[model samples]
Target chain A: MKDWRYWLAEQRGTLLAFGIFIVMFVIYTSNHPAGFTANVVQTAANKGVLLAFVAMAQTLVVITAGIDLSVGMIFLLTNCLASWLVVGTPMQTTLGVIAVLAVGLLCGAINGAIVIYGRLQPIVATIATGAVYYGIGLLLRPFPGGSVNEDLADAMTGRVFDVVPASLVVLLAIVLVIWVPFSRSVLGRAAYAAGSSETAAYMSGVPIRRGKFAAYTLAGLLAAIGGLFLTFFTYTGDAAYASGNAYTLFSIAAVVLGGVSLFGGKGSAIGAIFGALAFRTIGDLLFVFDFDPLWQPLFQGVILLVAVSLGAFALFRVRNRLEWFL
Target chain B: MSETTPMVGKSNGGIAGRMPKFIRRADPAVLTAFACIVLLLFLGSLYSRSFLSPEYLLQQLKVASFLGVIATGMMLVVLLGQIDLSVPWSVAAGAMMACAAAAYGPAGVVLAIPFGIFCGVLIGIVNGIGVAYLRIPSMIITLATNAVAQGLMVVYTGGFSPQDSATGAMRYLATGFAIPGVPNAVIIWALIGAAMVFVLTRTGFGRTVYGIGNRERAAYLSGIDTRRVVMIAFAVSGGLSAFGGVLLAGYASKAAQSMGDAYLLPSIAAVVLGGTSILGGRGSYLGTVAGVILITLLQSILSVMQMPEAGRQIIYGVVIVAMLLLYGRAPASR
Candidate 1:
């Protein structure tokens, strides 16, 4: 194959996800009464960014062929912590943000440690740790009330020059600052190798454990960032159990839609970000069409089922049945 | 783990005859879980005199029956090296549908339970097709179906709290005693448990489930219809989850939105705690029984101590991790 053809194959999932996002956004905005105005775009950007961050977190682990069930709880935990801490002087707010991020890193590290060293499966280990994170969050905000610095919240959530959403800029900056470096680094390659085939990766002497650990730890940091944004959006911390579970579940869906194989060893967070945006637009699509609010969940569910089923069409072409397990 | 393997093997040999043969041969995790149950009861008695009473223990067992039933289905899926994340909604769908059916008068009441289980089976079959035929990961497909089930229920109920109540028969099966000194729930659980044990040990379907779990490709090469086994396992999981929901609605006298939410993790926890491998293939029904009792007693004791929900959650997580650390470790492939 030509170099560009190889490149296209490599970037197929990401490009597909981006295309889906653009199509959905166009459909959503065209049907809206505001007709793609900046205000409408800003509102959608702010909502889409939350899941984007969580999905990115999920992408990191998924690349390592592992899943993090606690990302949502960590998001909630950091949100609750920020509500208590991300206040007062600007200097104090910075410290609080650092503290929350540190805690998020710690949570991810614990999950990594348990999975790598304790040898427990990622699914159950994260589920247990997720409960712990959620428990702490509940203790912090039992009744769903905590304040964020309005000035910071407004500035971060607002648009720049009345065109580009500030949150989108930050999302881009994060992609460059965190994702770009990580994906290019040796550790990232090891993570991919591990996900693709752990036995082969191990035989090749790849740093599988360290790579997986970094993926998991970075996932926590990303989820904490998501939680920080959530506090900014809601202006308070709420330890809603259902919401946490929903976010966790949605992130998985978004990651899959983004073309990240749940089987592990493929895809990018850029794809996941677009996947998240497209997923968020599903609810908006219903709103513009004048569906009953009660229909939102069912519509979202059906859309998800359809999007996920699309990924399965490849199985029909596989002549050998044994390959299905792979 | 490597170091202890030989030690355990040596102890089982004739040279080291100190430990009882039964103790040496039994699954250490199940024994440990039962020991924890006894310890928890002892701890509870210290907090309150009535903690050890037969009535209180029976009540705890009665409650555990619901979880026990749900975990039985979960164990089946897990044994197949897959999971069913749709349990929460499956449970809710079963309860809501059964209650909704009960509202249709006498015939509805008669068909409510079966209808509820049937709804769950439908959900499960969808999951099975996705996992078996479509080859989607069980984790993802079940999650999607869960959302679909949740949405369907919400639409069916119109976002309002469900208005239908459990029928007399439902209540009788869940709460009424068929034999003196034993609750109907306990009897039902025992019957289900007996059935599970028999099916797992005596049936070819059960053997195929274990074979597939251990290695699906190997099983398929061995002429097993691995897809059918997998699909059937998920279907049974959905049916049992709904049945558990039915009992819960009966216990509460009505079905509520999100009623199945609490059971999902606990059911998995119960099954895993009983020494079942989370990766699939190896486990026992008796071990699941021990796990169910342990978790139920742990909950009761924690409540008796007035432990806050936060503390309880933390403890629950810590205990699962700790137990997993003890015996749930996967073979060191990484």
Candidate 2:
């Protein structure tokens, strides 16, 4: 294949997911009573960005062939923490935000340490750490009553210059500042390399451990950002278990939809972000169609099933049955 | 013997001689589970005198049976190096279906158990078809199935709480004592466990599971009917999970919404804690039994200590991670 063709093939999943998001978003907005107004878009963007951040977080660890079940819990934990910390004076709010982000970073680091050094499987390790994070979060806001800095929350969630949603801008900024650098850097390449073939990467001196560690730690940071946004959107810190699990599940769905392989070594955060957005739009699409809210889970599942089934078409082409296991 | 053969035999014997016989002969996971059970019992007794009582202990056994049943099925899938995340909803669907069936006449009650298991079987087959035939990843497929099951249940219940209650037979199966001081649930679990043991140790099907887990390609090349094995494993797992849910409904006397939600992680935890390789193909029901017991005891102790739900969750997750680290780090035994 030509170089561009190879690149296009590699980017196909991401592009497809992006297209899905656009189509869904356009449908959603067109169906809305206000019809594609800035306010409606802002609300959608705000909701979509939270999952987008989490999906991005998921994308990082996934690229290294690991899954972090705790990302959602970390999102919850930081949300709970942010409610308590991101309040009062501007200086205090700034410090509180930093503290929440730092806590998220720390949580990710612990996950990395256990998975890489302790040699625990990522699924179980994160599930455990996720529980611990949730426990602390429960302790932090046992009754679900905490305050965040209102001004900061509004500024972060609201539209900028009366056009683009501020949350989308932040999401883009994160992509640029964090994702762009990491994906272009040595450690990031190492992560991709490790995910693709750890033995080969190790033989090639790819710093597999450090690369994976970075992926995990950065995943934590991204989840924390989601948590912060959750606080901003909800204006409260509730340790809601269902919501936490939902986000975790949705993030996985988004990752898969975005073209990031659950098997690892392929896909991108950009695709995951779009995947998240598209998934969120699925729910909104139901709302606009006046379906009973109770049907949302069923609808989401059916859509997910269809979307995922599309990926399975590739399997039919596999000549060897053994490749099925892989 | 040739000079090289003699030297190789001598070195092998030397290494064998230096290692402890017990370590070499026994599976470490079973031993660890046994130790943990003892430790948990000791701690439970220390925490509260009631914990040592026969009634309390038997009650714990009964409770453990629910998870035990589910974990048994989970182990089969794990043995195949795949997973069934659809367990939570499968359990729910089973309980709900059984309860709904019981709401009918006497005939419905008679068919309740089979009906519930059939529900699970149906879901399992769907999961299996997706995994075995469609070649989708089990994690995503099962997860999606779970969501679909949940949605169906919700729709069936008209978006409200389920209206049906467990029938007398269902209740008896979950709560009644067949032998003195032995709950029916425990009996059910034991029977299931025995059947699993027999199948795993004495049957070609069991060997196929291990073979597939170890290397599916090789297993297929050896003409093991790998797809059939995968489907059966998933079907068995789904049936067992549903049986567990039905029992749970009987125990609770009603099927509540999301009742199966709590079991998904614990089922995985019990199977993994029992020393089953999450990567598949190397574990025993005995270890799973021990794991189930230990977890039940630990839960009892934590509750006794007045630990909140959050604390219990944290502890549960921590213990699972601890067990994974302990066992996962070891080289695959077989």
Candidate 3:
């Protein structure tokens, strides 16, 4: 009984997700009147993988009660930069990927140093930096025009074993390499403690400053990963690859739905991945419904608010002890 | 009140030290921003000899008036230690409503003022209710309002620029010139700024705004109506934004559905740059004044130089970051 309680406590997000998955399975079966196909699953997984990387980046900073509005801008910039960097050059495509990741780290470091040294609140600081990053993208390509290397693009977008996408493999590698170590490490544990209560953590000898610096830096790097993945999805880049402003909401929406409290501390990487999948699936479902495409922005806002509100309500009830069931 | 005495020092140490302790803090944001404006002007003049003309400057000030007036209300909202993200939408709504009213001539124009004020109040109330009672964060509620505004504007105008007008006396607002040194709207904006300064310093409502902003729980405990104070703060912000929108309807000779979208970032930037706390209460109206000028001047300089939008945005971001480094830090925790 004790072990069961402990498992439930640690895996609440996963359990809630499983329950959702069951409901979704029943709904899809009834709607399609056929069992889920491999093709359908592959499509869902592909979209989920793209959003998952972005969501992971969002979760890292969000768990600290800070926001990185620049994530989308950084993604936009990196996608275009990657496309431009390896265009027709005999540069080892692998080396190009490494260089792109390095850029991501550098971008992340800039944000980390700004917040740590400049003492700007994460939201305001990021908003300003986002504009700058977008500007840099515009300079890279004044108009929206560029092509990706066909070979590399195919490797990323095409399936590895005809069942799993190459992009998915890279995304998994990221989760395995970065998110797993982060979730299990002692430093990761201290980061959680620091976020939970800065003063208490400081008193308990946790390095709050260092943890925040590392967290933001990782977020920046993850944003770069999101940008790289985007190049696979999109073969071209211009200044307007994606609306950077959207990141302010998408990242937030994913993490909040994934069960990370905006107030900081206590969340999971797997939960973030699920949340991103759910978010992307909703968008896909909207496409299936074939509503006016312009309704997308409004739909996104409503869905975001609904998802966030549900989380907020759950949090509020838990915090206020408002449960009334007999 | 005692806590804010230190804020005065944080903003302008000389004023705090030389003046009476009871003297309020001038917004350091305003001073720094003004310096930035002056520096930009000198650079502009140096780069292009013809940039310093009164006519050219008046044109710039006219553009600035739109943001400056709304920023007055934004200052009050920030003084209460909260944000109103709905300003962009509210401004858009006011412009559309005012433009619609202005179509009927003077009667419609006069009617537009109250109607505009009403819209602002309604939006403010909705925002306040969501934030205060429902306990949705102000950022989220106002952001949602922005989305609603975007949707509504698209529906109202059919995604096209609506014909409002500056054909009558309202044209004076858009293109009215006074002395060689001032545009009519700039003078009005200045008056509004002065009024804001007076309100923040002299009025009980203003002090309560600061009180609620600085410490909401303490303010409520001390018999201040903190929620009411916050509601009124949003209301004022909305009304002022509407006022700016009305003038805008006059200035542009018509209201475009998206005219207000650009004002939100700059207005909020002006407020923050002026040294008002993002959290609320300890700040200066003067600082916001500087913020408005700096932002306006930057836009003008960039426009004259024909910097691409991306590059301009980059510069704006960099300058803001630099300012944060200079003065935007939250005071080291005691």
Tens digit of lDDT per residue, candidate 2, span A1-326? 79999999999999999999999999999899889899999999999999999999999999998888889999999999999999999899899999999999999999999988888778767877888888888988888888889999999999899999999999999999999999999999999998998889998888999999999999999999999999999999999877888898889889988999876899999999999999999878988999988888888888777766665444875778667655
lDDT of 3 by residue, B18-84 (tens): 8754345334455567777889999999989888988788788788888999998888877766678
Q: Model 1 residue B141 lDDT? A: 86
Q: Using lDDT as the measure, what is the rank order of every candidate, best first?
A: 1, 2, 3
Candidate 2 DockQ vs. native: 0.54
* Chain A TM-score of each candidate structure, as shown: 0.97, 0.96, 0.88
Q: Estimate each model's TM-score.
A: 0.97, 0.94, 0.87
Model 1, B51-134: lDDT tens digits are 888999899999999999999999999998888999999999999999999877789889999999999999999999999989
> Across residues B111-160, which tens digit of lDDT does each residue of candidate 2 receive?
99899999999999999988888888787788788888888887889864
Docking quality tier of model 1 = medium
Q: What lDDT tens digits, residue by residue, belong to model 3 across residues A1-326?
A: 69999888977975665465446544543454234765566566666676677778878877766667788888888877877775565576667777877887887778878876677777678877887888888888786667777787777777767777676678778889998898677667666776788778878887777777778888778878877767766777756723665655676677767887766777876788777777766655555555666666667767776766666543354443222110
**What stretches of model 1 exceed 4 Å from their correct place?**
A312-319, B1-16, B159-162
Off by over 4 Å in 2: A1-7, A312-314, B1-24, B159-162, B330-334
lDDT of 1 at A80: 95
